[model samples]
Target: MDAATLLARLATVIDAHDWAGLPDLLHRDFTCRLVHTGEVFDRDGWVRLNADYPGFQRMHVEGLVADGDHGALRARVIGTSETGAELEFAVASFATVRDGLLAELVEVWADVGQDAPAGTRPQLT
Candidate 1:
């Protein structure tokens, strides 16, 4: 799969909350780094976290760019917590593809502040 196709599939998985289908797009030794928390996670760790969190109500990709073997995407995620409070976050994701699958992912995200809308600018900071 090319970078665009892989990223598009990733968006679909997150939108549908289909954790079971994630492995199909990942390498066996895939690794992800959470920029904010400085946490490094393996493939299994990614699956577990996604399973624990309630799925997002909506995710809008604001920008996407793909190079030969690299891709970058910025999106806005909107969801409601268990307490029914609305939440919004801007997420910037970078990926390196190898052998047609995602081998590494680095994600940087932040909660949208009061001044921002649910889907605003890309959060690269």
Candidate 2:
């Protein structure tokens, strides 16, 4: 598969929580690292992390770019935490594709901050 095709299919797998289908798209030695958390995971570990995420969530892809053997994705996730608090975050990931499959992924993510209240902005002259 081409870079774009691989990324789109990967998103599909994630949204569907289709763990079994992951191996078809991920290389045997695939690895992923979360930059903010300083954590690195192998293919199985990465799958397990998502599979075990704390609550119901949806990942929305906002943008994607692919060139040659690399791709990047920008996304937002909205979810309700186990504690019943609403949560939102943004994520960006860079991926390496080889042999028509994803060989590596490095991600950076952040909790989406709330805007100031309606009246917070200062009046301008």
Candidate 3:
């Protein structure tokens, strides 16, 4: 599959909680880096991490851009805790495709709706 199509499908499978379909879009040597945590995982490890994430409900792709074999995407992940509180995170990912499969991915995640740091910028008019 082309890079864009593969990435689009990636989000779909994850949102659907179809763990079995994830590996099909990954290369044999696939690697994923969690930029915020400084952790890295291979295909199996990455899949396991996502599958085991606590309270994971669904993932929604907010935006995507692709060029050649490289693509970048921003997605929102939502979950509900045991206490019934909703949580949301914004995840930004950069991915490289090799031989029509995802070879490498680097992701940075942050909580959504965080306020800007004090004095970082003036309020909008």
Candidate with best lDDT: 3
TM-scores for every candidate against the unseen true structure: 0.85, 0.87, 0.93
- Residue-level lDDT tens digits of model 3 in 1-125: 76788888999999999998899999999999999999999999999998998899999999999998999989999998889899999998899999999999999999988888999998898
Q: What lDDT, from 0 to 1, does candidate 3 have?
A: 0.93
Which residue pairs show collisions in model 1? Answer: none
Comparison by TM-score, 1 against 3, better one: 3
Per-candidate Cα lDDT values, in order, are 0.86, 0.87, 0.93
Please report the candidate that would top TM-score against the real structure.
3
TM for candidate 2 is 0.87
Per-residue CA lDDT of model 1 for 38-112, tens digit only, reads 998898898777667684687788888999779998889998888989999999989999999988999998999
Please give the lDDT score for candidate 1. Answer: 0.86
Clashing pairs in 2: none
Off by over 4 Å in 2: 114-125
